[model samples]
Target: MTDPLAGRVLRGDRRAVARAITRVENGDDSTDLLNGIGKSLGRAFILGLTGPPGTGKSTLVDRIIAQYRGRKMKVGVIAVDPTSPITGGALLGDRVRMAQHTLDSGVFIRSMASRGWSGGLSGAVSEAIQILDAAGMEVVMIETVGIGQSDIEIMKIAHAVMVVTMPGLGDDVQVSKAGLMEIGDIYAVNKSDLPGADAMVVNLLSMVRDMKGRSPPVLKVSALKGEGVDRLFDAVEAIRGRFLSPAGEEMRLRSVRGMIVELAKKKLLSEFEGRAFARSVEVARKVADHKMSYEEAAERLVDG
Candidate 1:
């Protein structure tokens, strides 16, 4: 049953792909489905695009899809957008930017809401990538929301992590806040037509030089005009060639394991609350009345 759906998706059935993604995202009795799908994964190259907002990430993603299409490669994109906490749906503005490729048979795009999951993405992204991989995409791109700091989660999932930036907007401060330089496998300066572009490049290069052997390659591009995109693709290909070894594959698996453990821990802790632990108001009242110190209250709850 899962094999047929997986085969349909690989044969360019968009509905099958969409249904698979929905199942993975909802995670509603889908483990068996995904276990079957996982056998077909591990073939696709997963690329993670992360950076601050207004850095032209969506535009760059569009250009990447175009370049891949030129090579006759199938591409799948998962665009993670901020969600309305109350409604739990995506604003989906990023998807609107990439609408030009909606009719393209080789490209599949899905918009996901962050849904308050922190880490600049919802936890379902790993499953989404697996679904796309099982669908036989040559490349699966994960575009994360531009939330600073949390965006580093991309490093755990992608074969290559592209940190996009642009001129102005206190690039230094942003890099520091996000700690992106440490996590990025490649640095992209988009919107290179803007002023201060040269200076930004210079600063990034200087920083890269200071970091010495650990720093990734930096490339400048103008996604709107489709400039330097080919070089970016080449860089991606090169990174894959150099790093996609057995050891590198093990590292990625370890990361996935860590994320799963962390998520399961959170879920288990939530299940233990109230029945095994005091409610928030009860703890607050205890603290307010000086019946227990905050640390003592927490220790008691955990001990209970």
Candidate 2:
């Protein structure tokens, strides 16, 4: 069959952009499209925003997009929401906050369902980002499904990962449990106007100080009222500048290499499971039941 999504991706068509993202999210021929979209994708900066559920990640992303748009930047957003296991549906409520941008030609927003992926992202997210990059987006932001801890997968693909948190969410135990200290390249204390905001910053700073190596800059902002957003933007630009340099590029390349290796390992294991290994498993099961010694079974399989 002809690849309609690939055609649209290469042509930079917006509707085609949406369609390609849908195909990726649904795991429909995404590998072919991604292969075509690679190398062309390095042009866009991939920003990953992740955090606890109430941290205002979607609002902060919306504000950042608006700021980028003001500077004539083309923005692509991938908002990942959890899928209902029973219904396989996602609310996609983040898109509603960005409705104003719908009228702006420069902004493209696509929502993805996590489909029960354990790492707080949909399987299609990486390919979707490539499609946006190929479509000429200068910046692509991925908003992960906010599932407290175990959201570290975004760190693998994002050039910079932002961990967002709010005031009074929990104790120091909560912060540690969330895995916030290790994953964030930038820490955003969103909703700074709320009570206990300073305490939150202090706790984060204390944690960073203790960590002592490559600690991300922590900034406080109120996404709802736009307080401290300019500072947040400045910090983001500075972080981007530092990380996109030669050294930063090296780190990015290393990350990409690691991802490829992991993908290969996964694919190889899958292939082995479906082929020669299937018969091996049955033989191994018999060996386990004492039908034959393990060594004898292994020798037989190897000889066969």
C-alpha RMSD by candidate, in order: 4.6, 4.6
lDDT score of model 1? 0.72
For every model shown, the clashing-pair count is 0, 0
Model 2 Cα displacement at 278 (Å)? 3.6
Off by over 4 Å in 1: 1-13, 83-103, 118-122, 243-290
Please give the CA lDDT of all the candidate structures: 0.72, 0.72
Q: lDDT (0-100) at residue 287 of candidate 2?
A: 85
Best candidate, lDDT? 2
lDDT of 2 by residue, 123-225 (tens): 3566677789899998888877446433466556777788888898884666567676777778899989889888999999888788857768889999888
C-alpha lDDT (0 to 100) for residue 162 of candidate 2: 86
